[model samples]
Target: MASKQAQRLAARQQLQQRMAVKAEEERRKRTVLWSIGGVAALVALVLVAWGAVTVFGADDDEAGASDPDVAELVDEAEAASDRCADVEPSGEGALGTPTEGLTDGRPAQDVYLECLQMSTPDASATESCMYTSVDGTSPTPLSVQPAAGTQKMTIVTNLGTITAEIDTAGAPCTAGSFTYLAKEGYFDGQQCHRLTTESIWVLQCGDPDARGAIEAGTPEMAGAGSPGYQYEEENLPVEAEANYPAGTIAMANAGAGTTGSQFFIVYEDTSLPADYTVLGQVTSGLDIVEQVAAAGVM
Candidate 1:
């Protein structure tokens, strides 16, 4: 009897010890799982906060005009749009400036956002409308009264109320550059030196003086006095379907990706592959272009 009792006690003690070991292991596993989840949640929160800061923080001037490739692209598009102002819209032109207030949660709102996002200045970057918003209550809906600032307007030579509707929507950077330089009087009294009627149809202006017909325009006389900054092309209208008829005010360049203080006016519609920036068409004073052309490099 004693031996049997001792054997039973030993068996019970072994089983209890085994159960304790198993329980300890399970507790450790639960603790480890909880700790891992906490770390993951913390990481996710940090990322979300960082993204918000980047989106809503104060705009950086350097970053605002950042992206050299984009600036060059804007220059080309603006120039091309200018030269092709009278051209009709084949489809779309360059990619438009991205507006960020469009990511609403609703399907239609999201679709509208997608369309705007996909909207290109020309058919080259064609995209279809994905959604439409009827109620305007989409998650990414723009504010009814958002802050769209009035860009500064600068007239280089007071071409007598040279009225123009600045295209603030299409090329903000380029527009801003022009306005900034103009307000600072960078192009005051600059002469229209070059008039090419063959491959191009424009009377290029912005030479400080038009004394002689220099073969290659010098930097001092070329469109060189702007803010020394360039912009990428945005929201270019199709050349074939543009509103700028003949006698349109436009921008000119020396070669590809070269546009600055110089401006031009189209007298005839000539087909050229080179781009000219169609900033704003002369609403009232197209006669000025004709007069300057008649005067020729004086």
Candidate 2:
């Protein structure tokens, strides 16, 4: 009897020790998991906060645009003209700048580099509805406010593909017009007619009759035509030093409500008045544009 009791006690002690060890391991695992989760949550929160600040800047007044510190930051950002990110041009263009007819006397390379620095791959998620009156001058979308979602506008060129996230919420009419035209193959095979190398850094395109001007175009005979209609302007950027940042795809208009099929992609921070409608922003393959811009107007 004594021997049996001693044996039972030994076994029970061993089992208890093993159970304790297992419990300790589980605790450590839980701690590790909790720590990881906490870190992830913190990162997510920080991103959300940063995004909120960025979007809130949509309204200058609300975003403290007049604040001295905020003004300084904006000034710093604009004056940081030397800030240029390195870009590798794999497309069919020169990788260097100072090409003939590219600069309006300024360091054009700085402009191109700054534009590259501001390029990003983020897409907007704001839901927009553009309800406006049209001149009926050209073919328009069947429904101005079709749905509430963003559209992906892809332009495939010999250099590469440049994709933009259409700001349907902000420029519904413009987006609708572009979408309709693209679906009808309107922009297909059209030449990117005009390449501006002066005050504005942009490549203008979408002119169906952009031929002949492919290599040689007069100032007035470029991408300057409508589908057959015109619409009211909507969603102008708020007042700012550089209202149009790089990677911005905006409607190229002669004046208000003159938006045609012709559009321009801003390759630098331009100080133009907020007279044009921001179509959307480039999300990918902006390097194609950078390469061309670097190669200069040809």
Candidate 3:
């Protein structure tokens, strides 16, 4: 009887030890699984953080490249007004005189604005004109006058399309320069840099370097960009009451005789001193400009 009881007790002890060993093995497995899950969660968080930084960094770089300053543009316009005061029109078709007739079938203008080359003795000998780059790939300025006539130009923009009837009769050189630039794709992907809702109501554009929609932090390339060349102004109004009416397309220059690629569209009857060269009249797409003006500057 004593032997049987001892055997039974020993059997019970072995069973308890085996059950404890099994429970310990299960606890270890659960711990390993929890550790693996934590590691995977950490890896996912790192990947998400890396992606966000990359995307935002790219956006910041782009914004920095195209950011523009409104105050600088206003200052530039004021400075241009001062420079134009010293300029006086001179040539065969000076302001208030009839233009020489061209072979192209266009009416002779009652008044013609001619380009007058001014001496810049104080400037560097290498500097032909302000902002004119001699190293650029664009065509050099022609010494002779361009033919005067009517031309239709189509301007395609991200917002919409604009078509204008260029009056080469009044401003032959201005029209010719535009035609040449258009053919070269100089204005493609360029931005309209300036918009003024106050005193002057217009949208200025044609800066190749300023190639983007107007937005906060967009670089101000207006008044700074050029077509690697400069030319004399044309088609200045002779009368004091002459004003830039709605749908008028005109060139934007730093001063008189400093015409380049920059131009503007008049959305309303805005009066100012006749400083800019009148390029043509907008046949379509004035509403695009009006819409931009209504939105105000970004």
The prediction achieving the highest TM-score against the true structure is 2
Model 1 lDDT, full chain set: 0.42
Candidates in order have lDDT scores of 0.42, 0.59, 0.58
Q: How do these models rank on TM-score, best leading? A: 2, 3, 1
Off by over 4 Å in 2: 1-138, 215-220
Per-residue alpha-carbon lDDT of candidate 2 for residues 30-109, written as tens digits (9 for 90 to 100): 99999999999999999998888678755543333444543443344334322222323233322334547545322222
RMSD of each candidate relative to the true structure = 19.2, 18.4, 19.4
lDDT (C-alpha) at residue 70 in model 3? 21
Tens-digit per-residue lDDT, 130-228, candidate 1:
122323442211111111222223232323323455554444434544533443344543444455433445666654333222324342343343334
Q: Report how far residue 194 has shifted in candidate 2, in Å.
A: 2.0
The per-residue C-alpha lDDT of model 2 at residue 208 equals 63
Alpha carbon lDDT at 98, candidate 2:
52
Model 1 residue 221 distance off true place after TM-score fit, in angstroms? 9.1
